[model samples]
Target: VLTGFASRYAEPESQTITIVKDNLKAVPARDFNLGIEYGAVYTIKRPDSWEIIYNGTIVNSLHEPVPVKNLTLYFEDFDEFVEIATIDTDENSNFYFNYTKYGNIEQNPLVRIMYKGDGLYNPLDHIEYGGIEMGADQNWWFYDEDGDGWPEWPFTLYDLFAALQIESSPTTSDLSVYLAWMAEFNENSGTSTFDIVSNLEGLLKGNTSWTSGRRDSGLLFDGDGIITPPQSTGFVKSVQYKELVFSTSDVTKSIALDVGTNISNTIPFVTIKENVGDDWDDIMVDVYFTDSPATVYAQRSTSGATITVSIFIVEFDDVKVKVQSGTFSNTGTFAEETISQINTSKAIPMAYYKASGGDDDWDASMVTTDFTDTTTIRMERHGSSGTMSGHYYVFEAQDSEFSVQKAVLSMSSSQGYDTASINSVNMSKSFIVSSYESDRANDDPEDGALDVFLNSATEVRAERHSETSYFNGFPTINVFVITFTGAESVQRGDFTWANSDTFKETDITAVDLGSSMIKSGNMYGIMQSDGTGSSDVKSAFVQHEFVDTDTIRLERYTNNEDGKGHWEVIEWELMSSSPAVYEDFDYLLWNDILDNVFGNTSNQFVVTSWIYPTALTSNQSSNNVKNVFFSKDGMIEIGINESGYLELFLSTDLVQTTARYGIEGLIQTNEFTYIAIRYNESDVDIFIDDFWYRSAVGSIGEPWSGSVNITSGGDLIIGAELIKYSSFTGKLDDIS
Candidate 1:
């Protein structure tokens, strides 16, 4: 038996055949018996690309034949490894065919097998088999588990868990069996690299019964609002907490206190002690950053009497936070302004205020009323005394770590303590209290015992004692409470720090955040201010800001001689608990079918998609950072360029010539938009939502008129360039 090739037409012509092998001679096409056991024969059409006899089998995990019968066979051409054709398998779960090999015999052939399982078996993931020996047989065993073919089930507990597909949830009530999904954790690395989703739109309840005098705990969520097991902790870690005290008399309108801590990446909370000898009037006190390191500027609205204030600063190592700080100048009795920084709807907002401008600006009683819709702050300005211009800070509130509460309590007697309950306050945490008179009644100084303290975890008590007259009146107090927890994404700590004695800048290099995970919008911090010493309280001012991701630079606006320096910094960040849409290097790749999709013609064709873009530029390590959309390298690309222009690129021979058609400011980040790229035979038109930009007939030139050969070098890629790691950080849907 011999094997060779021949012409398809039966023509009477004399043909000379040459055989290179010495042992075997070429057989005539009519006399050659191409049939062999477990093999089949086919004609080789071209010299460069030829066909070979290939066979394979499908089986279950137990190596038994997949009894479901006919299955489709996908062939991946060796030239591009793209799915070339689909054939069928026989009843025995075996397939035999003459597979075409692209390029040459030096390049191995490949086969991609995929099975859409029947009712009794789960479907198989596409398995690509390559590097087949020239003469050896090829066989594959598919693990067909017993289940409906939707989400492929893991073969063992050690297998990486992906997703679960179900037609319906269990109907029986009080079912005891646990339905759990888990990812694999690498013991050596101490991390789980698998990505999966656990979503329950329905009610999720804990175990109903705990017999034997035991009780089962309900669901628990972490600081990121992610459901976690009871044993898990490491969400929020407290580094340290420090309370600093200082005195700022009316003669000293502003004082810079040093809390000898790295105030670079921290949030500061200040409360001034009530001036017992002063009259009922609006008091303004604020904490600010100075150029001085480890120092914060404390300021009141006016200067006349002596008063003491305490600064509470918290430093957090790992927390999710958002902070917005700016000065608001208002001449009216009330003002409501929108803050774009506080964008999330899930968390509350905590605001701090300090009067700015002239001493007259501090006369009117200005208070932070409420943060509504999480983005707008309402400030109630009473007492037509002066304009209220000051610095305001709004931070995303996480109740477990820190919170600020305001309450109005009136003292009926002049010498007793009147208590009011503060709802939802954790009883086990520490508190800092500051009070001020806000009646706008008079400016006459009245001597009385005015002090406030935490009577209990949920209640606060105040005392008022008058020596000459009954100075009994209602006063508003702002309470600052801080708690430390081991299960939130916050870091709190303190360090000894001092500012430049002679007004200069101090720098802290690489604030030890335990990790280099700091970004612009996710991290915020506040620090406390304490005078240089207990006796000397001098007027001081300081400012601090982040230089980069990890550095903080502080500058002192005023000179200081001697004062107490105790500082505390609180830092927090926001984390994503759900599965990420797309990471830096993640993308999607498709077969080289752009030629088929667009065809070899200058005809009007439209391509469109609904995209929710987190960013218009790529965040990966590649030279093609601007290609944050779709790309078929060397042929065509559609993405935002480095100049933020939404452009479509077409090239005939990319190494020699290319053309680009784009529009500026049409695409934006953090927005959902419908984008369409239309080529109307003559010119190109791009539509972002209802807005369209047309490059008329001769403006940006025409789309490539004929077939741009799709080569083996690259295929169509979504979310990134073909040969690099430039990936789009967003969600995409309905591409056509």
Candidate 2:
């Protein structure tokens, strides 16, 4: 025993020993083993700061390496998704002590800590610990069960370090994460050995939420929700273009809409702004031939003022109408004066027809798979709310035998309808409409069941009216640059060349060096002398430079532990720098997957920038397609840039691209803003806030359809091409 160590009794007796502290009881993450039934006491001093990370070592007494398959991490009795504190363990089977800063409260804020008895988590695991937060309120500040709050006595810093997760990469053996199971037994009881069942790792799987050791399963998470399953809706709408405008999106992570509001929050009819006085606000608008009141997230907003606008409607003599079977109620309103100011040339925008979200039909996806001249791919509509579903009223409508009608519905569901009566609907973009459903199959929700939601009819309708367009015009946001202070520069070591010069949002990480010329003014360039040349570079975009003192490095993460690290440069601008000059030429869609360096389906290389349009708002030239010259890797590729853009770079040399804007309902020459460029395995896709878009498979590389070779790596730059006649020239901002 150490000098100051002492228990309640003069010496700790092997017989049942009772340890008590100021009415407080807590448990630290531990390891229980069936090999040795012994427990050791770990004492920690209460911490001062409100936030603390308690670290320690929970080990199986034998102190030997245990087969990982035999280890199990789970919480108390709640066998399902155990939402317990989960962290990756370290090497040496040691728990590098580190817990959340949250305190254990006055009472015990814990449940059960268990392990597997048979050395496997499959069947069942032994309960190493079992308790909940329940103790006197007086001991709250002094007792730290999680060891994160005010630390207490008997707990030394080394004790905390022992409990932390230590991961090791053995030079000879395969790398692994280790957890040491250590337990103690009381001879007073007949139990001699403790099982490795509950190894302080909560449930391997979790409930609702996600934790490690759960379903990462092999699928890479792009953060963007899958909008469509990549199957066609079996319908197509075509729009010819003279000069297509394109916007580039972050070409990383395969462009999940969940990452951007453009995909996550698209709804029909809602505008981007409350009011615009004169200029026509670029809007993504959805329109229909029929006029009717819509139901959705409804609200009334007003600054206690009213604007006068005349409306014109033609009221037909009471026409025969059916109201829900036998119910009949004639509701009609008189037409008023018409407003002449609103642009009436392009009301309902035409959409470049393709298959995306929407469901319950054999439409596009199936039609592509089983193409038949006679088979008119069916269209489906999830009931009224617009939530998409595999099933549709149109699938129900197809059997009725009206070819044209079926064709029209199929086409409409694929993209949208177009009419010349109005203009500028593409500015609002597309939307997703969906109907919620249930885990079970009951049609209506059970009484007091607490689970009643919409059906699978969620159809995200893009181009909901640009709210600003409703006001007459949209306002252009002013652009400004953030200025840096010299005191900060001095604090940052006088902006020396070796010092990091980037002004990142986090001051703790970024440094400003005064060495390179690029470091002087904007401080934008970052160089790594440690970078690899021809035969030795580990990363396509990184240098080996680091603590070695003489090397400069631009690795994804300062340390390799990030597991998945990425580096990107961002340049934001109100407009693009692409040249405004034009040469008339016929162009079909173009794709390049041949030469660009690509990443896996999980982590991809990305680049994106934006620019305004060439034509004025009043001009009506055929600006259906914006010329785009983009290449993911070293090879050159050309294609049409629209309101939306998506590109994917995959590990293999394959590259993919996806676009939507400027094709269907887009007006001639509206400014294209907010561009993104990205790439990953499986496919690539792009988006422009409201309507712009793009999509392509990663396997198709540069000189698309001509090469199936694996893609490698290369640098990326805009406004100019790495080679040849294809390149972009436009105004840009936020260039990193």
Candidate 3:
């Protein structure tokens, strides 16, 4: 009785099935699915350029072998390796192949599973649909029992293409993200068939949770005209006791003479204090000043009672001073007064001033009183009520003096910081106003600034610099400095600088000694006259440029005779005889060179010729640079030296071999003419004067050593070797 095992044809998608192979229960731990999204770690091999051996054998339900278009073969490592297997169907689809050298599963390489019409680059890997992505060469981080950042894996999957064939590449997001996304998408797709029908025309309102207000309150009322106060517990005076109503003028008016008042606005403001937000209804105010030393006071008003009042004079920002003028003529919207006039005479004036500029930025309008011209302008910032920020700039006057065309005030359209940025320059202060109007004078600029510039002077404050009042923008109080030269430049015309400062203004006299790293867009350059190194070149040096000069040069240097500098033929100009071109002996030289060709002393003679590379000699004293050229049958054979001489021995074996000759020199009948009289095998082929003379000579597969070393006065020439036995003479020359 014979029993056969078979697949459950009725349930093709079943995860597990009992198999009866020859009446035996067969199960391999679990069930395997041919087509499914599997998340299993695998041991994959590399797939290289190759042809598919076969798509897996297909079998029908009756156990008959068939063919299927499911087997995939891919080369994941480019030209590295390959995998060939078929999509086996039914009972026995296990793949097996014989291999001793190439195709084997043990050598895990890069492989990827191709799904989308066998296209390896299918987008389904990362698509919102099916199919999974694989790794290529990146080392994946796998977490296990120990801790995070552990690489404890069975194997490191190198390439994705190869890894997919045997095992799917592990990925981040674990199984959670995939499952979550899948579940979410499925739920969104539908709960039941009827739930979808109900919301078939669902409203596509924004899935947001924000509301402008409560519509219910507008629609329904509590039946009371006024909103009843919410239930609350009673509180003490500090947090809950509201301020008693009083007039603002009443508080500051009598409080100027009286000590203090019941209102708390007089508590005084902290330095850097921003006002508490506006809706306090109670009389509450906070001011922050850096230097004001005055105490604040609040007083109840006999002047008024409905409102509470508070007042504080921030004194530090408000300095009692006047402007002075120098080096400038008074003009429209411009005034100036001399230092003597401002200090001694107590007067201020707007003057047209001309200067190179100062350390801080200086606006032409604000410099009403300019006495001395500037060598270089940096500017003085007025952080407080002094001046506006970024509105002032030093000018490189094309003429003797730069004139203020207009006093432009930065308004709402203006950008950057509000108020003024005070620079740390030491100089006298002056005040002025812009002839033009800007909506955001005391406010911040649209563009933005590092910090808010407040006018430190007593005259201007936040509301005082209103767009309507100033017309343009706010004026600036500034400090200026006199330019000075350090000891950096005495005779060299180089700029005065200490080593610590990277930036310097210098005038190059003879040569440029600047650093190699030049700024990206600066016009920094050097000039040179004609020289032996490189010809005239007047251009800025860019990065990664190779500079070759006629005089100064940088080249590869080596101490040994061989393996010195890396040399390759750029273009071999074989025109050695050109008068304009001369060999400079810069070519490589061989060392300790010696070639024994055609030397005989006893019955048989042995000869050998080999190229002697000179440049790579370890022992300098024992090295000789050999330079020779060989020729064979109209072909100029290079680097083969031979001593002019030939010797033939009458061998016992009846072997027939002879030398050939022509008009140029010796000749041969075959390709390589290494003329060797042998009782054994092949050696050097003697090609004399561009013509093959004889076949190989000497011992078989060994160096030449017959009876030739007994006696002979052979001339060992550096260019060419000579054979003393036969008295043969050959010509050779050194390559210059």
Q: Which candidate is the best by TM-score?
A: 1
Candidate that scores best on lDDT: 1
Ranking by TM-score: 1, 2, 3
Cα lDDT of model 3 by residue, 389-424, tens digit: 211112111221111111112324232223433333
**All predictions: root-mean-square deviation over Cα?**
24.8, 37.8, 41.6
Clashes of 1: 64
Each model's lDDT comes to 0.39, 0.21, 0.21
Give per-model TM-scores.
Answer: 0.32, 0.16, 0.15
At residue 50, what lDDT does model 3 achieve? 20
TM-score of 1: 0.32
Give the lDDT of residue 181 in candidate 2: 21
Instruction: Give the count of colliding residue pairs in each prediction.
Output: 64, 236, 123
Cα displacement (angstroms), candidate 2, residue 456, comes to 92
Per-residue CA lDDT of model 1 for 1-736, tens digit only, reads: 2346644545587989964311111111121121111111222324455544334555666555554344444444435445444555557555565565566442233445455666556665444334211111111111223323111222121111112222123222121132222111111121112211232121111111111110111111110112222332233222322223334344223343444543433455443433222221223445555555555555555554344443444433234444555556556655677877444422233334444333222124435344555567655544445555555555544434355554545554243345667765544333332323334233321212234455565776554332325443344434333443422232112222243342222333344343212111000111122322311112222222334544543333222322111112224332224422322244444445445434444244455555555555434323333545666555556666544556555543212123444445656665555566665444456665533455422343544544333222256555556344444555544344
- Number of clashes found in candidate 2: 236
Q: Tens-digit lDDT track for model 2 on 1-736?
A: 3457763546555877764321111124454311111122221224542222323233443444322222323332234424345433356433332223334332222222233333222332233222211111122223456645333321111122223321221212211112122111111222122212122211111011211211111101111111222322111011110111112221111111112122111111111111111111111111111112211111111121111111011111111110010111111111111211211111111111122232212111111011012222222212222121111111111221111110001112122111111111121111111111112111111100010111112211111111221221111111011111111111111111121321122122332221110010000011111211211111111111112222223322111111111111111111112333322211111123212233222244333333333322211112121233234344323233443233222334443323232243332233434344333333333433332233342333331232243344343222222222232322222111
Per-residue error (Å), model 1, residue 429: 2.3
